[model samples]
Target: MAEIALCFAAMALRGFGGVLGHSYDILVVRRQWLSEREFAEVYGIGQLVPGGNIINVAAILGDRWAGLAGATAALAGLTLPSTLIAVALLGLASKLAGEPHVASAERAVVAAAAGIVLASGLRTLRTIREAGRPRLVAARAAIAAFACAIACVPFVGLPIAVIVATPLAFLLERRAAR
Candidate 1:
């Protein structure tokens, strides 16, 4: 458990811009924790499930390797530092909210985060498409629809729409296959 927590903690502290790619290589290629295909499958499921994809992945892999206790350890390790930083910075952010430089920095960070998310989606889609899965290719429309719903979160609210969209997305894919 400590090893799981420490490994995830190191991964988390490595920063976020290229974290996904780095993590994939480390866990699958280097650490031998998962195979490429298994990673792909888990990454897909993680993205489809609620909450941050990588965070979900940590829990999933941990559970697979060490059961419930491992999952808890991985999750805590992955989230703790960032969570603490966010909490610590919340007050400082509020105080500096009106400053021009702070505002610009915040905007930059937001843009980077959005880009990372968008790129992750695109990369996942491309990976799936390139995997020669005819069924998945035929169901691209369903994926697009789900993406639209996700984008509309600012209007429809989160978690609720995501929960509703998940099964509907699968249904749409089933329909699209016909």
Candidate 2:
């Protein structure tokens, strides 16, 4: 229990913005707890759930390994430290809200986070290709999904855009698979 908590806590700390992507590294490369395919399987399950993929990942991974106790431990470890840090940062941001540089810094941080997310995705695609899915249809679907999301973000908003694009993307996948 302690070890599971510690590992997930470390994963959260190390992952920051790209938790799922980083999980591939920490779990597969470092811990050897899961192989590349298993990591993909776990992450696919995480995506199937509604809320945050990373949170679902921690819970599912915990449950898979050690049942309820593991789930609790992993969730607590992932949330507690991150929550405390987020609260402290939010408080600080509120105090600094009027400063021009603070706003700029926030944009920069958000931009960096987006870059990390992009890189994580690229890494995942590369992994899938390396794992023998190199036919390029998945890549095309990803590009289409991304383009649709970009267009839809201004039209319908992000959440609805994602909701809409997801099924379209899946359909594209089904087509690609055939």
Report the number of the highest-lDDT candidate.
Answer: 1
Q: Deviation in angstroms for 16 in model 1?
A: 3.0
Give candidate 2's TM-score. 0.64
Q: Model 2 lDDT vs. the true structure?
A: 0.78
> Distance (Å) between predicted and true CA of 112, model 2?
4.0
lDDT of candidate 1 at residue 57, scale 0 to 100: 93
Measured against the true structure, the TM-scores of the candidates, in listed sequence, are 0.70, 0.64
Candidate 2 clash pair list = none
- What does the lDDT read for residue 82 in candidate 1? 70
Runs of candidate 1 exceeding 4 Å displacement: 91-95, 111-154, 157-169, 176-178
